[model samples]
Target chain A: MKRIILALAASSILTAGAASAETLKVCAEGAYPPFSKTNEAGDLEGFDIDIANAICDEIGVTCELQATEWDGIIPALLEKKCDAIIASMSITEERKKAIDFSEKYYNTPARFVARSDADFTIDEDGLADMVVGVQRGSVHQDFMEKTFPEVELQLYGTQDEVYLDLQSGRLDAAIQDSIAADDGFLKTDAGDGFAFIGGNQNDPAIHGEGAGIGVRKEDVFLKYALSAAIAALRENGTYKEINDKYFEFDIY
Target chain B: MRFELALQHWEVFASGVWMTLHLTALCLLIGGCIAIPVAFAMLRGGVSGWLATGYVYLFRGTPLLVQLYLVYYGLSQFDFIRETWFWRPPAYLRSACIEDLMGWKVCAADFIPSLRSAWWCALITFSLNSGAYVGEILRGALKNTPKGELEAATALGLTDKQVRRRIHIPSAFRRALPQYGNEVIFMMHGSAIMSVITLQDILGVGRWLRAKYYVPYEGIVASAILYLVITYLLVFAFQLIERRYLRHLNIKAPGAERGWFGRSAV
Candidate 1:
């Protein structure tokens, strides 16, 4: 009985310590490189990680990064597995119905990547029966489904898998974030023959107001805090520093 | 549990159900066909038997998910497979091979297209995995065939092939029906992994729904209910088949009527 009471007292003390420490658990996709990725040392690095850390620092909280798969990232946040999603999640209306988003930190248009030698126009007629790959549950999938209903769409769990299928000639083309496609695939050795096919696809209705940190609907305080942090980072040149480290061009 | 979300997206779930059903049916049909020869070979007890045993052991020894990943992802990694093996023919051949047949543009060159498609990869992997399991079940049933029946057939001057075909295989099939039914249901459940390779089977739709709405339980609960319905239907089918074929194996109740064919009606 005495030992049990002692254990309960110790658990209460741990809980109190946890409540006192202001740690913001941010979920990011480790598979998405340049934005966020796990290095050879198993540490999470990249633009998303840096931005998330900066936001936590501005909010006077310790940032804890959790690597999550893209497919279940939103659900993870809703389940309170993490406090926020700093993954490159587009602020679309459909997603807004499920979770609230901070102001956009970065915005890039979607683009289609295809083999360089493949001669095809980027239109409904050109891709009528072609199989186009997109990451499952992404805005790109919604855009493709709405824009080209006749085309066969193959959904992959990750952008990397879409690139893999594209490389193997299974996919006629793939739709993804332009910068992601450029850095993650087209710039790599495995993407030797592939090149961006279409022009920027920034349909406001589908691609939304650009990528933002996703927070729960009821976490209004956190959302505002994140939006303010993003603005502060931009003003202090911190955002530019992270952007320059990842890309040559302005991505803000 | 926002089940309303599942109800609202019934069409998506229906499509997922359709994919799962077709995949399961194709795998079972192809797997059952492969199992027969493999079972016979195993019974024959030669080098062929060893080969059959090895095939079964290899597939059954590993998880179905690993086998699926190997086929779907691993196979596409090889340039030879992507470029040549089972790939579409050259442009010249492709154009020349095109012929209209009953309003459908049929191209002979397109017959052996690459195996990189998710449907093809899933079908091939699931079929092979199902075949290994069904083969082992059939082999076990064949081995357990009564020695007296084989001897009786031999005494009647029936050829080895005749006795094996007429009596040996049929009896074993009847005995194997119950176990094979279970294998069918197992294959259906195992097919949920199709989602991993991006084929929108039942579980895939569920995952998609969860990802879309961020409602964790609705999609999963909906999927679970659909699986339960499928399993119930499968159980009913197996029961009907068992009643028709294996009724003779059941002990007769008092005053039960025997059918005209010398089988109990009950």
Candidate 2:
């Protein structure tokens, strides 16, 4: 009975692999809004997801959008849990050393947001006493750590959690991607008192080139395929249609 | 590759270790203090018993991470807390020691301010969580204190306080020490979650190092080794404490003389 069960399990596993072989597994951080987020209906619907589906359409492959925690997205790609990461992961030199990234899909600047009533500057001296919030394992965290070493940083697991702290006045300010702040927080009712405090921060060392789909270093073919599909989407006006649905200006 | 990177960032690891050690130690001490009273209340029975039971159940039922969020983020949602100030303990302490410390201690005035602080929030959440588990362990130990000893103490004309002080409490602690040691180790492991709140514990430092170097293995392995070392040291310390406190309960071995795996080679 044991031997028969083992053989059956093996066959089932093989069939499962075959089923997924033709499907293009695209992982995304569903918590990051405007880029990618889960809607009220428990479906992922956002710029990154739309863009990913468009790329799949261009490539003539069945697309599967999988929501993954941003922290584990790269590890998931490396482990073959997914074939590629369309998680709005910035194409930084540091990240490129580990995983391959396709051509830039979108570039968003970083900025600090605070309550409109509070008069705090975005500089080291200005932020010296203030408690700042940033998402853990994000480039903004790296930027804040390096730029404002003296400021008290409260790192949240998700970008939305940072807004929560900022809303409650627990955090004096929050540093994050500007577009994310605009669409995810500032535009919402919970962000009634908050406004962007400073000019956009754009240090390439931290912010990197832009967000790109991440593939494993060995998956050169998939990387090339994804890059081509992205380029085709831009040239064929599909990218613009999707872009207009989410944002006012060009994100590419 | 990971080891080389870890070695290069030794300072970060060291700082992380220091933070974890202090956070764990503080949490354990505070939690243990909270646990003892809760255990007593549980033993007493009635409304206080139910209250204590509810406290334990509430903490144990929820994830420590959620409890942390509730304290750090959820509690601050109220306007009363954000706009108000209460008595400050650190300020009072610094004021008391102002003359001796040459006013250099004035900086500590705001250390434990009345306002909500993320550090305090994390500490309180960890302590409450630890208190529940520790309380249950202690309650079990307290109940297991031999009834014969209590009867004998009463027969010897001992007062209730004397009986508890001389017999029950010490025996209960001695019995609970091993399980309590496990709780301490668990608390130490749980302290890694402090990284999410940006407190820079050993795990937090590891995270920072990984993000800075873009090498997860190096940071993760380095932190794991540090945690293992800390756990080993904690267990060793508990063993020493057990030996000292439970010396009277030790018995001679009935098995073969000690060797690898607690048995001599045939």
Q: Model-by-model lDDT, in order?
A: 0.85, 0.79
Q: What TM-score between 0 and 1 does chain B of candidate 2 receive?
A: 0.85
RMSD of each: 6.4, 8.2
Scored by lDDT, the top model is 1
**lDDT tens digits, residue span A46-153, model 2:** 899999998877766667888886665676676677778998888888788779998889998998899988786778889988888888778888888788888988
List each model's interface RMSD.
1.3, 2.6
The sequence of per-residue lDDT tens digits that candidate 1 reaches over residues B57-162 is: 9999999999998887788888787677464456665576545677777765545544766788888899999999999999999999889878887898989988
RMSD of 2: 8.2
**Model 2 spans > 4 angstroms off:** A1-21, A40-42, B86-106, B109-115, B253-266
Model 2 agreement with the true structure over B69-140: per-residue lDDT tens digits: 787777777887766552224434546544446644544544564436666777788988999999999999
Report chain B TM per candidate.
Answer: 0.88, 0.85
